[model samples]
Target: MQIAERMQGVSGSAIRELFKLLGDPAIISFGGGNPSKACFPKEVIREITDELLRDKADILLQYGATEGYMPLRRAYLDYILPGNGLHGELDNVLALTGSMQGLDLLCKAVINPGDVVLVEEPSFLGALQTFHVAQAKLVTVPIHTDGIHADELEEVVKKYHPVMFYCIPTFQNPSGYVTGAATRKRIAELAAEYNMLVIEDDPYASLRFTGEKVPTIKSFDTSDNVIVLTSFSKTISPGLRVALCFGNKDLIRKMTIAKQGSDTHSPNLNQAIVAEFINRGYMDKHIEFISGVYAKSANCMIEAMDKYFPEWVRYERPVGGLFIWCTLPEGWEADKLFRRAVERKVAFVPGEPFHTTPGAGKNTFRLNFSAEPEERIVEGIKRLGDLIREMKAEM
Candidate 1:
């Protein structure tokens, strides 16, 4: 069978491939970025789902608009957007099956083959794949512990003049770094000045456990070039596959058209459930509850790392998000460490695959805390720390 040429260079998701190793009950996985199962508001979801079936069954069971279920658009406007200092009518919003779909739709809507798309150096792997599949020429800006630097970002934008800049400003995937407010504002300014579309993928902003909440890039978007993709996966439920994008009406329309042939429409029932989840005043309490759960998990992971890992193994304790990004000493390959750790029933994602630049991040890895319990998190870190120590001694 002949596969499409676009897929020739693109490989399967590293995390998904790693999931095949998770069937072993002995393996305590720190690999996948999954929300803690305990964080789910099961009773609330069950009740909401049951009520939707009982009351809104006719609308939910029927086909939904490709644009989206109207209530979700309104709910997003009423509940989600205002918090981010954005306000818009229905035309500005489009429901997505997942925030990942927003990336795909955006690519389909605007990206042509070889169009320059700027991204954070270590970005979300899934978004990188989407850009690759679109045949976009991927360029990257470096990310520091604090996040992308504003001056550096401006330099790159001026140099590349990219069509789109994709970023995860708050608790960025793999890195778990928050781009500061000043940098975020500068990004929005640069977007307007350059006429570049900035895709702000913000799924983890609501997960903050420490520090002040920084304003979103979209909040500083004066020229309307910044597009914000918000996800309920981390906050509400990943299985629901409910996310929404808000931005320039023209861009939203293009993505809506693209979505038509993709899923026809996001599942009406799921949208309705999320809308009800918000409208009924459940989102805040739920987020607060889950944030505490994640906070405890983060603390546990950090404590374990501090106690178990050697001083040479460097890492930043994330303020929020599921991941802890770690860097082994120079010339130490994390891929080799991953193999040895897996043999001992521990797993994490190696970092090289997250970079577009050749031979980058070979000494790095990402550990997710939210998927496992406190004991499992501690145990997994111990196993990984032990493996790292053994590798370092051999060096």
Candidate 2:
């Protein structure tokens, strides 16, 4: 059997591969970016699901509009967008199965083979894989401790003239870096000036535990070139696979058409569930509650890393989001460390696959804090740190 040329070099996700190890209850995993099981509002979701099936089963079980379930589109525009300093009409919103589908849809709608797509260095691996399957010419701009530098972004945009720029502006995945408001505005402006499409994947924005809220790039967008992909996977439930993209009406319409052939519209029941969650005044309160849970977890992980790891191991203390990005000393291999750590029943994602640039991030790795209990988090760090020391002793 012949496979498509676009998928020729693409491999399975490294994170998904790590998931197979998670079946061992003995293993303390810091690998996948998963929200804590304790954080899910199971009761509320059950209640919402019951109510929807009781009253709205006809509409939900039937074929939904390719555009989306109408209530979700409105809920996003009226309830969610204004809080983020964005406003859009129904044509601007498209419900997605997950934010992952938003990337695939955008690539289908706008990206042709060989079209340039610029991404942040160490951006979401899922997005990278989608772009790869689309056979895009991938370019990258570096993200620092703070976030993507505006000057570097402009340099890349000017050089590559990319058709799209993908970013996780708030509480970025894997790295947990937040792009500043100024750079965000500059990004919006650059997108307009260059006629480029900016895909702002913001699943972790509301999960902030510390630091001031930054305005989204779409909030600064004037030319309708910036699109915001919002996910309920972190804030609500990943199982539901509910998310939406807000952007240019024309682009959205294209994606909607593309989506018609994709999932035939995101599951209507899931979309309704999210809409009901927002409309029932439970959204903010739930976020506030889970934010506290993740905050404590993040603090626990940080304190453990400080207490257990050697001084030479460097990592950023994330203000928000699930993962803590760590860089080992130069010449150290995180892949080797991962192998050793897993033998001790501890797991983390080796960082090299997260980078599009060849041979980058080999000395780095990412740890997820939101999935495990505090005890597990501390234990995982201790095991990883001990293995690092053992590896160093051999050198």
Candidate 3:
């Protein structure tokens, strides 16, 4: 059977492809958004599993409602709300397979083929893939430390009047920049003023190592214009595959319809586990431990870049999150440097695929620190820096 034209634009993820190439035992990869296996809280989860089975075996294994287990959804809402400074009744929360599923469902509800979708330039590649699969025409807006530039966004709003604006506002993927409160408020205001839907994908908010906690765009929203998606993959265990989505009830009702048709519901067993984890208050301690490990690793990476990388390979020391965004010196080709780095047993994601505009981020690369130990991060940067120097020599 011939495939549809939409499938042509949808291909294997560049991040996943890079991860595949780094599967060799010899390489240290900073390419994927994998959680550190060390922080899984295996013992606690094991006890929960045993206790749950000993007590509630049938419910643990049986089918659940399309909206999810009511208690689990309620617990999840409570768990995530205190951090964001937003509180709503039980109806506000929807459990998801992962936050990625939530994004897909939102696209299914709001995006028609060829509808314009405004995305941060060099945005999360996965979000880009989701919009691409929905067949939305994506336009790029530049991202700064503050967040998506409001002026550029206003220009796009004036021209295309996009249907939705998608972003990973906090500890944003690939870029490692946090959207400041001012920008967050501005985005909310603009979305309200222009009558555009905003999708905030914040999977890494709990990984902060420094600075005050930033508020979500949804916090400033009174007009039901923003949808927020978050996940336990970064904060808790990823193998469980559970996340949360909160938004305007009308939009959420449509998303729930799309979701029911998509997967029926996220796994009930995993939801039960996550609910227990959160209600028991294990998550807070787990995040603190995870933050310490990641903070040390991020610090090590920044320090290595300062000591070993060529002076022109500039990067921001992200206050939190798993990744750092690095820009090569002018005229250096990051894709070529990636090849050399892989040859030397070090791996990273080339920045080209992260952009909505082709070739716009050719001199940039993203390095992840959460998956590897500090020693490995140091060694990897040394190898990558050597490759950078060689690329400069060739130029």
Candidate 4:
């Protein structure tokens, strides 16, 4: 059997591979960006599912529209986007299996082999894999604590003339960085000026725990060059696999068509569950509740890092997000630290795989605060810190 050329050099997600070690009972895993099961609104989802099945089983059990289950799209348009100061008609929306599928469908609709796709340095590994499978030439710009620089983005756009620019503008995945309103505005403008499509993957936006909410890039979009991917995975139950994208109608139409060849349509029952969740006005209360949960966890993790880790290891207090991004000093390998840490029964995702640029992010890693209990968070950080200090001493 022969594999296709598109998948030639693409590799599995390092984060996904780390799941294998997770089966060990002793390991304190900070590796996955998984929402705490405790945070899930179990009773609400069960109620919603029961009600939907009782009232709408025939329709939901049937195949759904390739576009989406209508209510979910309407709910996103009505309930979700409005808080971010975004609005879209039905034609502008497409429901995704997860936000990751939104990326794959976008690649299918827009990218030809070898077209350049610009991404933030250390962007979502899942997305990098999708682009690589689409055989796109990946280009990257650096992302700081504040976010990617506007001027640097413009420079990259001018140089590469990429087909698309993928970003996680709010509470970015690997780094927990948020691009400010000013840069977001510039990104929208650049997208229009360069005729480039912008893919804003924003699963973590609703996870914001502190500070004023920043405007989304799509909210700043005047030329319809920006498309926003919204995922309920973090905010609701990830197992539901419900997400959607809002963007240019034509592009959305293309993606919708591409989606037909993909899943026929997203699962109708799942869509109905999320749609009812939104329409019932549970979204806000739920987000606030989960935000409180994550906020306390994030605080606990930060305090632990400060108390346990050496000052030389760098990281920031995440305002709203699941993971804390950490930078080890130059010449240190996070991969090696990861092996030793795993032996010590602790786990974190090494940052190198999140990065698209060769040789970048070798000394960085991401720790998820939303998965484990506070005690485990503290213990894991302490173990990781000890390993790092021990490694440094050897150096």
TM-score computed on alpha carbons, candidate 1? 0.98
Deviation of model 3 at 80, angstroms: 1.6
How well does candidate 2 score on lDDT at residue 34? Answer: 82
RMSD of each: 1.0, 1.0, 1.3, 1.0
lDDT of 1 by residue, 1-395 (tens): 99998787998966578778579988898888889888888898899899999999998999989989999999999989998788998999999999999999999999999999999989899999999999999999999999999988899899999999999999999899999999999999999899999999999999989878899999989999999999999998899999999999999999999998899999999999899999999998888888889999999999999999998888898898888999887898888888888889998899998999999999999999999899999988888888788787797
Backbone clash numbers for all candidates listed: 0, 0, 0, 0
Spell out the clash pairs found in candidate 4.
Answer: none
**Candidate 1 residue runs with Cα over 4 Å from true position:** 13-15
Kindly report which residue stretches of model 4 are placed more than 4 angstroms away from their true locations once superposed: 13-15
Write the residue-wise lDDT of candidate 2 on 286-345 in tens digits: 999999999999999999999999999999888988889999988999988888788899
For model 2, state the Cα shift of residue 332 in Å. 0.8
lDDT of 1 at 172: 96
TM-score versus the correct structure, for each prediction:
0.98, 0.98, 0.97, 0.98
Report the lDDT of model 3 for residue 303.
95
**Lowest-sum lDDT 10-residue window in model 1:** 13-22
Flag clash pairs in model 3: none
Kindly give the stretch of ten consecutive residues in candidate 4 with the minimal lDDT sum.
Answer: 13-22
